[model samples]
Target: MNIKFSGVLVGMVAVFAATSASASPRPDAGHYEWRAGTQAPGPRAPLAVARRVWVPAAIAMTDADVCQSMMTAKSGAMACCASHSS
Candidate 1:
């Protein structure tokens, strides 16, 4: 009787999952309005790490190429310059 009860429970769970999957919410349709006068938001810049992380802050220098190299060294391959800025 335990085996039979387990089989019924499994069947019920399967049916419930299938029904829930079918009843999933649909994506939003085009019903919103955009105001003409409002200005669009400016592009966001990527997160900046402190210069000290890339190089010693007390070096008393400001060099773009050196900074880029230091950034790449600290962050490895994940480090990249902004394409728009270049």
Candidate 2:
């Protein structure tokens, strides 16, 4: 019985040590490769254009206009600009 218990304990310790060793994050986990002349393939172009155009337009727009637009788009539930009146 003692030999059997010792064998089980040793097996559990070995498994635990193996798992703990592999649980650590790799050193190059955050590294990314950026290649030249390669555009990111997605809806990123429309979003980028919108950011360059829409952001400045939105910033220049009145607070009331922005709040009304948000309310209309989001079913009249505007928690962010609720205090502003159009």
Candidate 3:
């Protein structure tokens, strides 16, 4: 392509890109913001470090220990007082 035509082609592409960018919604408008102290609304929260400790113990758990450990894990959000039951 000729130099002038190449430059025009480049300019046309740049203009198209700028127009496309401006036509889209602001990027932040589609995002969710979480506030401090308020936990996200869900049936369950993501697992934390202390909670992960129960998995090995949970695998070894007897029928009696299942409900007890589950409540301990959920309520504390971590296993501070959870004594593993065999």
The top-ranked prediction according to TM-score is 3
lDDT, candidates in the order shown: 0.52, 0.55, 0.54
* Residue lDDT tens for model 3, 1-86: 69999999999999999999999755544444333444455668643322211111123334645555555454445343334422
Q: Which whole-number lDDT from 0 to 100 does residue 33 have in model 3?
A: 38
Every model: Cα RMSD to truth = 19.4, 14.8, 18.7
Model 3: how far residue 81 lies from native, Å: 38
The estimated TM-scores of all candidates read 0.31, 0.31, 0.33
Residue lDDT tens for model 2, 9-66 = 9999999999998887764344444334434459754332221211111233447666
Off by over 4 Å in 2: 27-86
lDDT of candidate 2? Answer: 0.55
Candidate 1 at 68: error in angstroms? 50
Clashes of 2: 0
Query: lDDT at 83 for candidate 1?
Result: 35
Task: Enumerate clash totals for all models, in the order shown.
Answer: 0, 0, 0
The alpha-carbon lDDT assigned to residue 7 of candidate 2 equals 100
